[model samples]
Target chain A: MRLRLTPRDPSYFDLFAAQASYLVVGANLLAEILGADRATRKDINRRMAEAEHAADDATHTIMRRLNQTFVTPFDRDDIYNLASSLDDCMDFMDEAADLIVLYKVDELPARVSDQVQVLQRAAELTAEAMPRLRSMDSLQEYWVEVNRLENQADKTHRKLLAQMFDEITDPILLLKLKEIVEKLEDAADAFEKVANSIETIALKES
Target chain B: MRLRLTPRDPSYFDLFAAQASYLVVGANLLAEILGADRATRKDINRRMAEAEHAADDATHTIMRRLNQTFVTPFDRDDIYNLASSLDDCMDFMDEAADLIVLYKVDELPARVSDQVQVLQRAAELTAEAMPRLRSMDSLQEYWVEVNRLENQADKTHRKLLAQMFDEITDPILLLKLKEIVEKLEDAADAFEKVANSIETIALKES
Candidate 1:
């Protein structure tokens, strides 16, 4: 029997890259929120919300294209997973920022900034790697490095939690800080998930 | 153009229901852990881990079948998402149990049990709904009710947080309890996600 194959559309890669770029914007916004004074947090949060919305649109575009195109660059499931994972990263980041504003957290441990830094590096790596998905080449390092970064974030998370319990006295303040830190840690975890989805696609195609 | 259709396999629905069954076991195990004394905590956690492993196996079977089968009951992405979301619910439950063990949390607030009850009900609803996915009929109520249960879980989560800050004086204990509660909340959230995936599939297929 003869097999029929539809022509591949490369625009999916563009959309993926665009979505990853939103993660970068989101990471930067998170880092900024960590450093910004209380006076600026509201504005920073608004910007983060905007970034999250932009990422959502990018995800919708990918999904819409998947429905319209008979053939995708990779498995349709991989595309959907990648898009959702990227969206999750932004969502957690936005949630973290919102928590800070909602909780009116005045001070954060330095380790929170450290976690955001890990997120920034992972976001950069993700943005760089999304375009490489078209060929599925040199993408293994992207995921491996992301896994390492997530591990680093995990260590920082544990240390921060331990320190908070050991040093923090006020239960209310501890609650606020803990929620923010966990969300940042979750963002890091979401980034690793995105990388894992990309790696899965690579393995399946290769 | 002539469209060729492949027959849908019903085994997938079986696997999904089996996975949901593990969730029921897990929810009960979580409730047991919450109510059990320290002496039985280890045993309960072990049981939870086992349930999680079983759910993982079910998820793997679904994925393997998805790779081998040409036609599925619904979109392949929806199948994968539903399976993963169910697996995630178990993972979070296991994590919460493990956290209780790891933190050696002496006593939990009564509301923790309330959250687990919501999870139990949602799990039951999910198990009942997975079989109906084959026909995509009467599944709407399953997801809508799950969403309501998740909202209920959210209120309990916030109330527990408030109580932790208000009544719990020890910073260390508060931190431990908060993490466990959040994980439980996350499990509830994952269940709703599974329901949402099912609902999406139902809408698309109908």
Candidate 2:
């Protein structure tokens, strides 16, 4: 088989990596928000908001590049989807953090941390994979790993939901915690969507 | 501007129209579920499951056609995003319906029907727009109207959430209703996303 090559800018990869890095920042801040005292959660929420804005900027840059360039390293739609999905992951994390503050919840379940860990790991994998997208080489492992993490997150989410309904008695507190957990699960789902988009690109390019 | 045309299949438009029609079916079923007695809610939920499944098939068909066709009526990525977004709207509606059943939510706020009405209108506009995709003409009204409906849905959603937190005292019931409301809001958000995708396609294609 012959190798097919196309003229494309490497900067798209740089922008994608930059965007994935924001997910890491957002996830860590989410973890901080979960573990921080009520006094400190406000500051963490502010930082998460800033991270989400930065991610949004990266997404816009990618979109601008997509419009100006005729030939891309991969499918234009895949690039758009990947960038949008990464931004979505950050948005969900921000939403989860914002809800914590908005609802004024003082306590969280231990499983919240478990889900954050999955997010952090997935973000790391995503950051590592974005640069390798230019070559489309050995990228299958990235998506596979991300998929596995998402599955683990699903299980953690189910367990947390069950525990929340079965154990929590305070009505307002239960409502707040359930929203937070659901947002975290949404972030996890968004990460898997990013992975799926990458897998689609790899399949078409390879 | 020069008129540039690519050879494309028209069947993809049919599939999109078919998918949008499912949203109508799902929306109507949701309205029924919201208004019906508990015994009838079960039957409505079953019908919703079927609509969701049918939407999934339409989505898969679009994807398969995307892979097989060379040139498309619009950007291939737009095609994928439009199909996926339509499917997502249905999925969120299905989730909301299932949650009502899963949580055994007895009474829904009046505003829930308001949001469903918005969804129904948006679905009708989307179905009407899909056929016009072939010429990419007179499609602007569809997205514009859908956007207006989405804004109305947002207002209804906010009002419902405030009402729930302000008046609902039962913890478990509060949690259940909040989840249901959030999912409906998400479906509205998804519909707006579909509209946004269509707007993008119109701008690019026209």
Candidate 2 achieves a global lDDT of 0.84
Q: Assess each prediction's global lDDT (C-alpha) against the native.
A: 0.85, 0.84
Assess candidate 1 and give its TM-score to the true structure: 0.63
**C-alpha RMSD by candidate, in order:** 9.6, 8.6
TM-score of chain A in every predicted structure:
0.93, 0.92
lDDT for each residue of candidate 2 in A96-131, tens digit (9 for 90 to 100): 999999888888899999999999999989988887
Clashing pairs in 1: none
Instruction: Give the winner by TM-score.
Output: 2
lDDT of 2 by residue, B108-173 (tens): 888888988888888878878877888887988888888888889999999999988999877688
Position B1, candidate 1: lDDT: 21
